[model samples]
Target: MKALSESHYWATNKKKSKETDQLSPFKVLVRKEVSDHVHSWRFILLLALVLLTFFASLYISMSNIRASFSNVNDPDHAFLYLKLLSATDGSMPPFHILMSFLAPLLGITMGFDAINSEQNSGSLTRLLAQPVYRDNILLAKFYSAMLIIATLFISLTLLMIGGGLFFTGVRIESQEFLRIIGFSVLTIVYVGFYLSLSIMLSVAFRHASTSALTALGIWLFFTVFYPILVNLAIRAFLPDAAYLTQGEKLAYNELIMDIMRVAPGQLYSDGATTMLMPSIRSLGPMSMEQLSGAIPSPLPLRESLIIVWPQLTGLLAGSIAFFALSYYLFMRREIRS
Candidate 1:
């Protein structure tokens, strides 16, 4: 009886251990993906580049920040922290601008090979053969990448706040802090759009190089060539004529801005500028009546968000659409060992 009772106790302990070890397949996939990304050398290199760019811009912004505070009557007095991010010595761009260019690269780097690399290595087949659902694989990769991105931008935001406090000795106001948070979130959304796009390319293309090059091409077109194309379109649409009325000119300007904002980079820049520069009242051309009575005071955080709602919505929607398309493509594709 004593031996039987001891055996039963050991069996119960073994059952408990098995229960503890039975983690959800989704959780396991997410953990594995996160671990892989955190350990990868390419991710480390890209992270270093982003940090270098951020600190260089921050140094330039901080060094010249005093100029913004020099004028006694300057409206910038109420926004010293905001100025820390936007102010520049003209030798380099501000933090937000540099981030606008670099954030997409980080996103693309994390996701461009998310699936194809696994597929090529034959691990994807083995992974799918486990108890994991098809949806779990794609969702795991996306969520893991997003988790890393969110962690990165949040860390940067905290660092910016701390660095500003340390160097400038200026206490950040509540609204300023909120605006900085909004800017960081906007940047994450911008990066997320690229991440989704890169993931979609990875799903559609078999080779990782093809997906990487395609993502870079899209980035270049949107960042560099798209604006040029928009300018040419504006010129074609609204020719330079002396007889154009005020209303017509305003309409033309609005149309051109709408065309320009179609690019994700423009959306991000417009939103980040609005969040970081509270003095910017409108993103589009203002009529005489609308501008005549408006004061130049810095807007509250709520108003700034209202001004950038369209941009924020567009970016989020684009991210969702791209991820949805990628999910669809990945679900339908066949895999073999």
Candidate 2:
């Protein structure tokens, strides 16, 4: 009896080992997530919308740039590349602003149902039973969505550069190219924060719709009304400050600026504005004392980076914090499906 039991135990252990080693678990999970996103109707529609808006904005901007190329007198037109990407016909926002608004939709759509949909369909239980480690499922979803966003950003960057060259008949300068690259990278980081935020929502809520609406609510608040609300609240607190001295006024403005930076959109827009409009030096309100003898000149790439590094750091921190929170919550979540 002892000999028979020993043989059976070894056989069961070997079978389990084989099951766990059947395939590359991470790749399997990533492939599954990528395939689902690629084939989904929502992704298709979202891609169509992004492309339509971007190319239309690009066309409008190119026309404006051509019309003004003859009048260019900024010594450097230091903003030639940025102008190509952002200068509109005064009828619409720039291409980059349109992108900023549209990108959160991509994040919310891809991530809002990450876990709950699987649970609803009764597939979550089966996925957990697979040979892959449990954490691979969550990581795979994030990495797959990140990969899609990165590819989209890169393609758009190339399209912008190509369009600029073809329309203007001039090669992009090395410095301009680097600045554009930096802008694209920062935009990705900004969008990634939303992606991670939506994923955390999915992990927290049991219903995908709930998570999606919540994510969209947060997005709209930041993009549309957050600053207005902040300004109003500041005034409410300082209702009698309209007659304040110049120094007091400057201090009040600085206080509001710091508060506005709490929103990711504000940080990104401020940073992008500075990088694109090289003439912008101070993010905060500057009195003459602060700007004494400051010439109106375009900043170098290094200087722009130094100015925006804090914003970049904030974006990176937000992305990592949201993802870490999601992971922690997932580890503690009960697998009921």
lDDT for each residue of candidate 1 in 1-337, tens digit (9 for 90 to 100): 9999999999999999998788788888899999999999999999998888888878887787777778556655568888878888889888889888998999999999988999999999998888879899999999999999999989988998899899878888999989989998999999999999999999999999999999999999999999999878766776785778888878888988898888999999999999988888899998898899777788887988999999999999999999999999999999997
Error of 2 at 204 (Å): 0.5
Cα lDDT, all candidates: 0.90, 0.85
Give residue 290's error in model 1 in angstroms: 2.5
Q: For model 2, how does the per-residue alpha-carbon lDDT over 219-300 read when each residue is reduced to its tens digit?
A: 9998879988997898678847768998998888888899999998888887777667777777999898879997778888
Ten residues in a row with the worst lDDT in model 2? 69-78
Number of backbone collisions per candidate, in order? 0, 0
| Top lDDT hit | 1
The local lDDT score (0 to 100) that residue 99 gets in candidate 2 is 70
**TM-score for each of the candidates:** 0.93, 0.89
Off by over 4 Å in 2: 1-23, 72-78
